[model samples]
Target chain A: MPKPNNQDANSLLVLGGTSAVALAYARLRASEGKPIILVGRNSDKLKLNQADLAARTKKPVDIHVCDLSDTAILDKNWNAVTSMGHNISEVFLAYGLLGDQLKTQKDSQKFLASLNTNFVSAAMWAEKAFDHFAYKGSGQITVIGSVAGDRGRQSNYHYGTAKGALEIFCDGMAHRAARFKGAKINILLVKPGFIDTPMTDHLDKGGLLWASPEKIAKITLKAVFRGKRKIYAPWFWRFILLLIRMTPRFAFHKTGL
Target chain B: MKPVLSWGRINDKYCNVVRADYFADPNLLTIAESSDNGMLLAHGMGRSYGDSGLNKGGVIFQTTRQNHILDFDTQTGIIKARAGITLEEILRVSVPQGWFLPVTPGTKYVTLGGAVANDVHGKNHHKVGSLGAHIMRLSLTRSDRKTVICSPRTQKKLFNMTIGGLGLTGFINWVEFKLKPIESSYLETENIPYTSLDEFFSLSEESAKWPYTVAWIDCFAPKSKQGRGIFTRAKFSNYGALDIHRDDHIATWPFVTPALFLNRFSITAFNFLYRWRPGARMKGRSHYDSFFYPLDGINHWNRLYGKAGFFQHQSLIPLERSKEGIGDLLDIIKESKQGSFLAVLKLHGPEYSPGTMSFCRPGKGVSLALDFANKGQKTRQLLERLDACVLKHNGRTYPAKDGRMSAQTFQTAFPQWTKLEAMRDPKFSSSFWRRVSQTTS
Candidate 1:
């Protein structure tokens, strides 16, 4: 058990328990001796992660399996986890589907599923976490956005739009947290570049642009602790995305980036 | 996909690389089943000095992302982890808990899968044997879509074959190994400078009681000081705290050092200075990292040899012929003037590893490892001559460190190649295996 700051020991709640980035962040905070709660769709993956984190941290690791896309049951899912008497101090929303752009563009079912998981479902969960944290007036919520969210691209406009909306929601949540007088609530939005994760494994993941999940996780944790509102992971993506967004409409269409 | 080079960077082959996901790999079975042409090999860290981890014009399953601790028993010191987890990661968790790996190579960057595939050894080999001896069970996923759980008591043949199996048997999913209990992460060490082969042997005999023993000989030393070097030995200290070394200030070689930087003159000067250094004969407490993997402090230290890379030649000679065999080998290297940057010598006990293709012999012997810069034909010829010398002494070169061993030499050294080849997953193959087995895709 963690050395308690008050009556209860603070805990970290990861929305996407099996995500490489989320797990990396969890490991970084593991030395604090805080309990961790992992939520994901796959129970086997969750159990494996639970074992891994529990061993490394030597602390309690709880797991809950729920399809994040099922927005209808998010209330029940959130209640099932938060009601377990873990004084949740931080929540990391790090799950999404990078659906096939070409396939999803032609298929509405895939498009909605991607949109629902990335935005609607994710937004609903974020709201619940934000409300819970805001009610306590002392908590953190980190959402993993993407550089693609800065400017829409034809290749991944659906994902870009969903992440863009999520970022906007995070912006509002940060503002809301500030509105709570004397509250220490913090909201961090981390927009990462091309991370060399399994999600982007299909693409040619070479060159200086691609970053590892561990690197992003480190950057995200630093930003969370420092209470930064928004930042691009790897730092270089800020300029690259700036250039892409600055490109003229006609020229941008010609480049098809 | 990009080209995955070996640690030596000798074989410049562009491979179709596929990385496993963090906790789940839904396509792993599909990829293995489809790549039935024997061009697929599992790769982790790419730490092997040779092409055992490389497959040209083939798919390489990169398992680094699968790194995760599956379970750990603090009471029994038994730990089960994904094959992709590195030894450094294991130590970070285990060391503070008063446990350590049964056997670790010179570097902790190697993955559990790579360590098992190579059946790596440490200075403690004489006491605890190779890493294969400590492994309790392992889960191997083959190309046939079967996950076989093998241990010493069950699936024994496959279990033995998988150790030192060069990742050819199948993909190692997870490994359950016993950890040696330690009161502290520090070791009581001693460095004794010896002058000749005879004195070195005497020192080895004297230090038989030590758990870890190894020597660093200057290959460029004059004929009189031929086998002279510092013989270092160590055992776990009972007085220090169990704390893992935090490597926050490791120095990395920024780039490939110029080939001209490491010439005969520089190496000879370094060898002279290193031998006569102030602490050459010092005795004190040392951290396990400094005592076991001093080279690991310099990240990408291999780049010091230059862009063309270097070749690591490790050979084990029988005890009876060790003095003469080692003398002849040193003479050959000295005459060639192809001095090595790191030359290590150690005595091995008469302990056999469970791995069928393990490089160490069942009989007592002495193993010598040296690294020579890739001077093209000069280096190749020198290594071949060294191979001939080892073969004359009825010794075998380690496949894990070998980049170019003729099929004849390999077959002569390890006659059981046919057995391992027969059991090799038809869909799995490596450049080293192909070259040594004289097989084609």
Candidate 2:
């Protein structure tokens, strides 16, 4: 594995900065003196997360309020931040909603909202970040995916389908970024199994392979620095999901997973 | 049923119960089988010091309940039973019939499955090797949940991997291995004391000519008497000369002696008395139970270290580094003033099994076991210093006894960690692995 570079001394932009994973990533990186621009929807939540990052790194964290759902506002914030003297070295796209599966089945609005948050917003953010990295010819983009995307289950097929689309989008984006001159952008699709986070707290007990956020963070950092392709946060999830995916359809359906 | 905390002991910050369980039906077979998951392996007696018998929160098709003798071929001394059979139970049934477990640990409370998981070795490791070498065949449940019978000739990799794989590759349901036929339950033993380090090494080397040999050293001894201990060697007595004690199963010490009981003053007094009391014993006779597990008589003996628990730093330095490495470690321990009453030094013969990860190697191995008072930062610092000495001598620490070494030191000690990591199923993990790898979740 490559040692962490002094890129922390440079300026960075996080498209969904209020994300727990994003904030954690930025805080760990900021400790090395990196300046961070945190873009999110809620100012209060973003401020709280920003304070957490600042406390750990003791470095000033800049926050910009912009709803990712609003393309105009997101574009405005992106242009304004890039217009500043800060040269963005890395961009972390970490934003998604675990929309209620039952609610989505009954309400068209819930289904559309889940689809938009999970896929559309993610693609838009990646597109903008890819364009910036393509222009600079050097940057890293990491998009957090889910193990759910490996195969659809009866319980959360809708959510899985959305993440599946997002992962494929990242794959395409990585291919495009490779062609840009001086652009060293690589899309990291983090396929984490059940994570014990605020988003999934209300759900029933998770599978035996559930990983904690801290574990996910450590593994993610290692993968990013190592430049691993399609990294599984805990690494064991790859084999487990592979086994699950390879099982015969008749036997798989009977598993009651 | 609520689980009672009977015989609570701590090792390396993790608390374990020597004999604690919630279930009541001893004849029950609670197999949590799944079609997709592998066949359920049962863990009866939890004598596995490491993660061999444990997978945190995973299904353990507990076979403690099904511990019944299904059949016994007394003519050939071949016995078969449900997988939950324990060595203690087997000893009770078969010892009178002139048969004993081919290999055993310091304790007889371990189950058959546990014996396979750890592939435990005995004082006779030099002669017979580990328990895995004696097994004829084992019934395993593969990842695909198929009941597969494996031996050295069939499913060879699975057989080898499952023997010492710590139960990660698959679960072992039933096993049949050869048992050594003993002439009697009595042992003709000899205890020889050595005052100097050199004397101890030479004596151990000389005693290895016998069938079984082990030495118990006082780790707290001063440099003037470093490596001083009693070398005990024994073999089964002939039928006519044996005095069997069948009803001697009662354990006298059921609880830990007070915390202050094992302090420096007491330990020093105990060591002095032990070395001098048995001054000249050429030969003697004793029951096999007493001869093998002397400390087993003391229930909850780990409680002697108090509630904070203790760390067992056992290292095997190569024969080339024996003199200097052992001397340096002893000096460090003395200078640090760490009170360790029990330090065991043994001579390891050539590696016998195909286990690539076995801690045993061809060398004169010295295992120094210490009972740290678990005094927060001070204890950790001492352990780190000891770790440095271990690394300096190119020695490796036993994973079963490790409780305080850092992840870096662990990686260095076991360089095959990356390969092991590659084979690990993310869903299967242990508290030991998680702590060492810093995988919190």
Candidate 3:
């Protein structure tokens, strides 16, 4: 778990800022009177969320609408936000799409599109955050991974593959940042299991196993504060994932988790 | 459609839950008008203990996503926000900036809209009155699809009715309210144990000047130790020494404790251990969260009451008769040997709520909240007996925490409810309203 520091949460730059996890984090920081800039599509939700965050934090919150699918310069959005005089001290890369494996399996366009938004473009955005953190010699980044990425499942292998790749990237980034002696940046790989968010609202939900976005946000922020590199949210998921990992491949295929 | 229950986990109802993002959503008013059975009402955090926020066989217009704060004035301390935002969210931002809700109930999870609709009072009812006191202006859409902005200065009738109108007047769109200025997120506090009802009254009188005062009484205490508990007084700590951050651990109740274990013996033991606390540690500074919402530290603590679920019987009687009324009520609970772990008593001053249907009036009122494990009809009979005693003393019970108050009890307690009923949106109703109206109508 990451422990929150008295680190004057300078300014936050959140991409796909309207996602449940993203919005929940924004709400948490907003309540703490921290300044934030939300970047996402859907101008209405952005405006509404911006208003919600503004009222919550009593701090100025700016919204920049960008289809992550269209443009590749959200680092420019971060620059635009920072140029407005808000320093980007903490950056959360929280934008992604949960690709339907069936659709991706049917068409190359769908597979490429899913990979572009969930992994390719997201990785580019992470690189931008890394470069800025590397320059400052200090910063924190929280990249949301998933339990789906823990193993290849028939239901969502595309989404899992993209997230799995992001996990490896975080592992590599941790070492790279560590190797740079002056780099004070900390990167955390957050694997949240079965979060009850709007994106996953279509699925049937059960008791105790599901985590609300607010609960996940609190865990993620605490992890960021502790500067813990890898974590399974809700604490119990670590054991659940461990069990899933240890299962024999032949038995795992039959169980169909 | 999904099944939802109140915070008490009692009064479960299934409804087509629709999340409304903004007032502009066309489906907002349409859903209410189109409900095939019962009425449509907006539901926010679902923190109400009873069915006041529940609508069976209808649509629930969920305002959680509509929780956007529209504007804020730093210097004036006035904030404009959508009705769906919670006090917890507000406190998170405001406390750090030296601003706090003028009046907040026991929990911070309640949404702004629900707080106003319930007209909730706090321990400081002696000073600030109910949550509706600070609301400057708010817009509510009626069944006719007309949005009206009601304030004390304009639309006085609806303003008074809607303040504690139980969200029947319409779906509250947004609200603008003033926040009280505070120096820090900590409070200077003192706790003095009182052995009897007389001592509790004296403590309240001595601490009357304090902004906040409340008591934790042992409902199951023997006659010799009756009304015995701690009386706590608090004032805000100074700004310069303010921590301006929260660093506390929060735990959750993972599962329901079995019904058999939550019997009289278990409850009595829990009450004894709880009352024994604070006597050894008489005085100290405490965080505002611990001061206001102690139960929030443990998420879903209500599950301790068991799977059958529990409902709180919170009734307030007049100040002059509190000693007699509350004493008699506690005696009944002691004899029954079936009640709660948390029995709260607070002295309400002459501060009046602007809502015509507001529960708080000029009284030295003591609110006794007992959580009864649902033994089916047995629980209902227990609450009804308590209600009979409270009503005999010219007292009123809070509808927000009620699931079983008789129609006569509600009508007699809140006479103005009739006038408000006439003004309510035809398309908006709740299970609580329908239940209580059974005999009254």
Give the alpha carbon lDDT tens digit for every residue of A159-213 in model 1.
9999999999998888888888867888899999988887887787678998888
Task: Indicate which candidate wins on lDDT.
Answer: 1
Report every candidate's CA lDDT: 0.88, 0.66, 0.82
Candidates 1 onward: DockQ, in order = 0.69, 0.01, 0.46
Instruction: Write one digit per residue (lDDT tens) for candidate 3, span B167-256.
Output: 888888889999988887888888887799899889888888899998888887889888888888988877444443353548889899
Clash pairs of candidate 1? Answer: none
> In candidate 3 chain B, where is summed lDDT lowest over 10 consecutive residues?
B240-249
Weakest 10 consecutive residues of candidate 1 chain A by summed lDDT: A1-10
Just chain B of model 2: what TM-score?
0.83
lDDT of 1 at B267: 89
- Scored against the true structure, residue A205 in model 3 reaches a CA lDDT of 78
Clashing pairs in 2: A8-A34, A137-A182, A137-A183, A236-B426, B26-B65, B27-B65
Fraction of native contacts (fnat) of each candidate = 0.78, 0.00, 0.78
Q: How big a share of the true inter-chain contacts is recovered in candidate 3?
A: 0.78
